[model samples]
Target: MKHARIGHQSIPRWAYLLFIVLAVFVLYRIFQHRAEVAKASQPPVRPVLVAKVITKDVPLYLDEIGTCSAYETVQVQAQVSGQIIARHFQDGADVKQGDLLFTIDPRQYQAALDQAQGQLGQVKAQLGLDRITLKRQQELRARNVTSPQDLDVAQGTVNSDEAKVKSAEAAVAAAQVNLDFCNIRSPINGRAGLRLVDVGNIVSGGNAGGGGAVLLTIQGLDPIYTDFTVAETDLALVRRYLGGPNVKVQTDLSDGSIPPRLGDLYFIDNAVQPGAGTVKARAITPNPDRALWPSEFVRVRFILDVLKDAQLVPSQAVQISQSGPFVFVVKPDNTVDLRPVKPGQHQEGDMTVIENGLKPGETIVITGQLALSPGAKVDPKPYDAGNPKSDRQVAAKGAM
Candidate 1:
């Protein structure tokens, strides 16, 4: 018997290809799932930069914006009216006290002086003649040759001549004073400003009301004054150490091209400004090089006291959370702990003064706190204060 023909059934090429693709996908998924499980089982060890908490003396200070002012400002004006014959100093020259600055025409004043002197001489001659006449009249009266009324007249004439002589002498003194006024001199040692009047320019004399054509302006630059203000809330603290030995001020230009100038606190306004709610204060700083100029803006650091043995840390080490400020402290086992801290003023060199909750010799994380949690292991690295890039990197991470 013929058996039923056995039919050969073959799978399609596309179907086999599909099966192989599915098997490969399943194997890949299995490997990926195992990798994820392994990753979840082990915690990541983060790398961080850290610094040691230090102890040092820090200044208790108030920072403020201030302006430089001349210790003395003078608007020089003519004291006697005349044509300016010559200028003794150039514009913007440095002058000492009694240095001649200008010369006015002195011809008229000299002529007036000569006339006054001539009048004085005439009066003196007349007084001498009258005195001789009085003596002769007294002799005649003694001989009974002249009347008493004549002698009295002679004495009155001599007295009148003496009065005239005194009047002439006063006029002569007045003329001499006017002559001296023709030469204008600097009253103080200072730097002169631009000349307002040129030679041959006639300037009017200063009046009793102190108004006149201002010839020049002079400003005293050495030992300049820096004017600043303190907030009303801080006034009490400033007043407590206003005149104390530890109280001092340091002024620096905003550009910081020049070094800071140390000074003494000079003045404090008695009352606060009504609108500003700040009390004005002044500091006298030595500016021997004349580096400080009038109306220049500067930064003022009013140092009240010094804190001895204060704990300090890198400013970037301090982190702010919802609770408050905290720092990540590294332990001996390379683990970190979150510590709450009371931070004080930020001092020079990017340092923060820790008023509470930190001790000297402790290590705190300065950077890489973004990836850390409490009790997390870390790959520690030393903080480099001198490296500016480290600060910028920390700032960027902290910002994130």
Candidate 2:
């Protein structure tokens, strides 16, 4: 280096050589330290728990609490008041229209009818006398012994008697009507309720129990109605399903854990209640066994429509993140990836309908997604649900 230097600068050859060796060694050490640090900082690729692609049809049951109602209900009341002379129907008995339910005292109505009949008899006897008198007058006039004015008076007497007889007949008819009203008959065919009065108790004209206490409640149990409500958010979607030219609703109502009865939708309220934030809907159910009762609460199901071949996922896989509802998609390389999704109706138990952003064949992280990061290496554990044989397989394969 000194030999190559110009006159202004001079350097020894050994000094230059030593400086280059030290620079080369420092560069090598730096590279070695950098490699060690990079290896140490890189996370130990942890084996993560994962699930395999599960392919099956998920049953979707739209669940909501609903109530039951009777198709036709009537309150049995006594029309005529007297005294509770007899009870014709038992409590909770099924009755037909025109069946006698209660019997009030017929004595008062019978007395009135008897008085009317007596008046009618008296009027008939007087009319007979008038007829005889008129005939006698005519006979006398024909013999030139009776005056014309006297005969005319006899005719007027016969006419007055006839009008009196007609008036008495009308009175008898009205009294008969009142007597018939003493027997309280059922207006419709239905299930009857409890009896309000005993045989000896007196009943006022208005009600049987003397107060507003219902004498009996009769409800039609054959074809019962079940009422329910649905959220306003589903209105448009359900309307589209039910508003078609010839569309109808399919319903299910259950009591307790027993399987619900299948019913048909028949009525929907015209107006939506803004305060309740729901629409009232009704369905008809066959109550052949009297399983449905009046005022009994029942669960109602409304089938808006069916989603054909819609992608579905478990509710657990879906997580609410900063963006929106998303799922941890498990890639084939045993790494976790995030995917957004749109959720549909919530079905029974662990199933939910995926409206959008899901594929049928794609594997979603069903478990252990909370601690996953993008591109993190994982040791996937194939979890086989349902079948006992699959559980054995996981254990036998040593991937537990």
- Every candidate's lDDT: 0.91, 0.72
Residue by residue across 157-189, what tens digits does model 2's lDDT show?
999999999999999997898788788889887
Candidate 2 residue pairs in clash (backbone atoms < 3 Å):
47-379, 48-379
Could you give me the TM-score of model 2 versus the true structure?
A: 0.57
Q: Best by TM-score, which number? A: 1
Regions more than 4 Å wrong, model 1: 1-47, 121-169, 207-210, 377-381, 390-400
Q: Of the candidates shown, which would achieve the greatest lDDT relative to the real structure?
A: 1
Deviation from native of the Cα of residue 150 in model 2, angstroms: 10
Runs of candidate 2 exceeding 4 Å displacement:
1-63, 118-170, 207-214, 241-258, 264-267, 270-274, 306-343, 346-399
Worst 10 residues of 1 by lDDT: 1-10
Task: Indicate the residue-level lDDT of 141 in model 2.
Answer: 99
